[model samples]
Target: MDYIAENTNFKLKNSAVTLGKFDGLHLGHQLLLEQVISLKKQGYTAVMFSFSYHPGNLFSKKEFELIYTEEEKLAKLRNTKMDVLVSYPFTKETSNMEPEDFIKDVLIGKLDAKIIVVGQDFRFGHKRRGDVKLLQSLAETYGYRVIACEKRKYKDSIISSSEIRKELKEGNMETVNEMLGQPYSILGEVRHGRKLGRTLGLPTTNIIPVSGKLLPPCGVYASKTIVDGISYPGVTNIGFKPTVGAEKVKGVETYIFDFNQDLYGKFIEVELYTYERPELKFNSIEELKQKMQEDIAFTRNYFLKLNEGNNSSYSN
Candidate 1:
């Protein structure tokens, strides 16, 4: 995938484009991308137009914590087979452009877009003054096509990155994973820790999450970690280790089962599968160790059941 800046003065012949924040690339965004990919197969170049920052963040006083940080968002987009990724920084002047000018300059003049795929409720231009109807209205004059994707659903609620963020903060891992079509994962480099787990017989590699990335509730979880192209069963703790002391600096410490090679400085991806228990401050170090043993046991059983189900399916 080729990444281009927004202000780049370049023109293409024909392209199929999708526009969105694509924060987490949730099911809804995936549906739109699939359409772009299909259009590319039909001979148009696939392009994705996204803002480096959320448009809403431009006017809001409160800082927005992204579901996936900007780097993570780009990483996910690179995995797709899109021809071009145009990322532009949002600015006051850009936001104040008229709907018509945006169409003529951005859609037609810059990208030479032949087709645009957007959600039914998609909006653009100054103060979100543009909608799908406006796009359709200008389609013929601009010589482009507009495709509106219907809302995607998981269970009763429509799937969205905002809803997923709220659920993750509330520790609803099961639903988060269901709507995401995969486990809720965090990617970070393994950092040096207090080595407290080693003393307790459950060694763990500490993780320092990317700044401004939203994290799940502080607790222990039945999780798995992927390292160097291999997946391993693991247990993770996300929070300030209350039992160790009163320091509240948040960190993710994961103990990989059946593996003990040093991992400091190596990056790892931890997938939270199930919530085991909340962060507890035990009265004694012995008590903490006992509870940690229970967490490991639960993690092991969870993977065992998962593997058993896999075997059962293959046998059938």
Candidate 2:
């Protein structure tokens, strides 16, 4: 996919665009993406348009963390059939743009959108004055069609990014993964740690998350680590290693079962499956090691049952 971020000088032709924050790219967001991608057969460029900053950041004083960072969002979209991704700069001026002006300048003028896809409740431009009705009203004048998709539902509630963030913060991995349409994964390069795990004979691969990346509560999780495109089940600890140095920076550290290979500086994706236990501060290194062993056993069994039909193994 072509990523256009902060740079929008060029225009795309015959595009089918979907606009949204796409923060988590949850199942709800996927519905919009699928709509745009479906237009590829009609000779339209599939484009996903979002702002460089979260739209809510303009009105709130608190820092906004994303379930998927900008890089992570692009990474996820690359796997799809979509052709283009736009992270348009969001400034005070753009936020105040009139609804019709956004459509004229962005949708038709810049993107040359032949088809516009959005959720039923989609709104835009100047105190959120824009709505599906407005977009539809101008469709004839703008020479583009509008596709308003219904919101995806999970049981009684709507599948949304806010709800997924809530479930993630509460350490409900199962529910979060279900709504996400895939496992909640942390993607980063394996960085060097203090080698404490190695000394304890439970060596791990560590990844320092990027700034503004939202994470679940610090805990041990039954996870699957993807190394070189192959997934291996493991136990991951997402915390600040309070038992050892009590590092100030939180990190994702995973011990791939039956795997022994150098991974420093290599990129890996750790997918959380189940929240196992809370992070604990042990008095001794032996105590921490013992607890880790128990976590590993539990995680192994969890994956075993999860993949019983496929005859999964713990080995890499």
Candidate 3:
């Protein structure tokens, strides 16, 4: 797949494009992506057009944190059938573009869009005036087809990135994963730590999450660490090590089961499955060790049950 970002000289032709922030790329966003990808059979290039910055950040003092960073988003979409991914640079001037100009200059002019896909409530352009209706209205003039998808819901509530982030902040991994259509994962390069886990004979791989990346409540979680594409069950802690000595930046430290090969400087994805407990400051190192052991056991049981369920379903 091709990635276009920070540069505007590249061009795509005969593209089926889906436009959105695509922050979490949840089920609702996936529907729009599916629509664009489906047009590939007709020989149109599947393109995902998103902005470099979250639109909310431009208007609000409370900066919007992303469920997936640009790199992480690329990693997630890299495995998909997408032909092109464009991260349009967002600026005041870009935001001020008139709705029709956006349609003309970006869509029809630059992308050569043959088909456009978006959600029913999708909006864009200055003062957020554009909508699916506007796109459909210009379809005839632009010579492109407009396809709007209905919102996806879970238990009658709309599935969205904001909702997923809310659940994540509350450490509701199960609900977040369900809404995401996959595990909520942190992808980063292994960083050097104080080796506190090593001192306890329970070594772990540590990673510092990128700035503006949303993380769950500082706590221990049942997780899976993907090393070289193979997933290993793990007990992960997402926080500063308060018991040993609190760090300035947050980190993701995971103890992968049955594996201890050197992983320093290697990039890995740690997927959270279930929340276990909050980060605590133990009175002594022994107390911390005991709690960590318990967390590891819980993780083992969690994956064991998951495997059993998968096996049962396969048999059925």
Candidate 4:
């Protein structure tokens, strides 16, 4: 797989290119990617053209908390048949380019796009001046095919990254996970903490967050902790501890319910299955421990029911 920055030195001929931030690789993005990948059977290169940073974040006051960072995005796409991954630098020059020039230069001239796949709502080039109509009109001149994938829906609701983010922010983990086509997860290295969970008698492995990553919510969750390819049931807390003195940083602390082993400095992944409760400020350490005990009870029952349901469904 080729990783090109700015523009490729060599023209990528007969490429099937799709453009977007592809933040979460949600169902909508996956639908478009399927179209891109399908073109590979006809000998076209599968190329994903996305900017290094989301364009919205550059102009808007709110920074985009990405579901998948650059590394995570690339890692997620690794198993797919994508041929080239280009992170075009989003700058004033690129943003100001006219729609025609973007098609003529970046898409046709620079990337050598043979087939372009995008959503009907696709916009590009200078204040979102380009749309599907413009690309369709120029397809004859550019000598390429245009595939416009319609909006995808799940359970009669339109699926989008923003919608998923909304669900995540509200701590609707089940719905968010369903939209993502898999478990919504964070990948990071285990880091040292204050060993406070140890004091509570539930020693935990602390996980550092990926820079600018979108966390599900600041709370406890029923989760799975994956370390070295082995998964363990876990109860995770994500937030700055208000009870144990204020800390500026937010972190993930997971107590593995299945196994115990030294995991400091190990790169691990945690998948939040369900939101349990919000972070609370307790008056005393004992009070905090009491709530944590209830949280564990809820966490254990959640997984047990999940397991029983799966077994029942399988037996049926």
TM-score of each: 0.91, 0.96, 0.96, 0.90
Tens-place lDDT digits, model 4, residues 38-117 = 88999999999999888877788887788888877887787688998999888878889999999998899888998999
Give me the runs in candidate 1 sitting further than 4 Å from their true place.
5-13, 309-316
TM-score of candidate 3 on Cα atoms, chains taken together: 0.96
lDDT of 2 by residue, 49-111 (tens): 999989778779887989999988988898999999999999888999999999999998899
* Model 1 / residue 19 / CA error / Å: 0.6
- Candidates' C-alpha lDDT: 0.84, 0.91, 0.90, 0.85
Q: How accurate is candidate 2 locally (lDDT)?
A: 0.91
lDDT of 3 by residue, 273-299 (tens): 899999999999999999999998898
Q: Count the backbone clashes (under 3 Å) in each candidate.
A: 0, 0, 0, 0
Q: For residue 96, what is the lDDT in candidate 1?
A: 96
Across 1-316, the per-residue lDDT of candidate 1 in tens digits comes to: 8888755567766999999888878889889999999987789999999887787688897777788777666766777888888887788888899888988998888889899999998988887899999999999999999999998998878999899999999999878877776677788888878888898888898887876788998899988888885788889999989888855578988989999888888878888888888888889989988888899999899878877777322111
**Prediction 4 global C-alpha lDDT:** 0.85
Better of 1 and 4 by TM-score: 1
| Span of 10 residues, lowest total lDDT, candidate 1 | 307-316
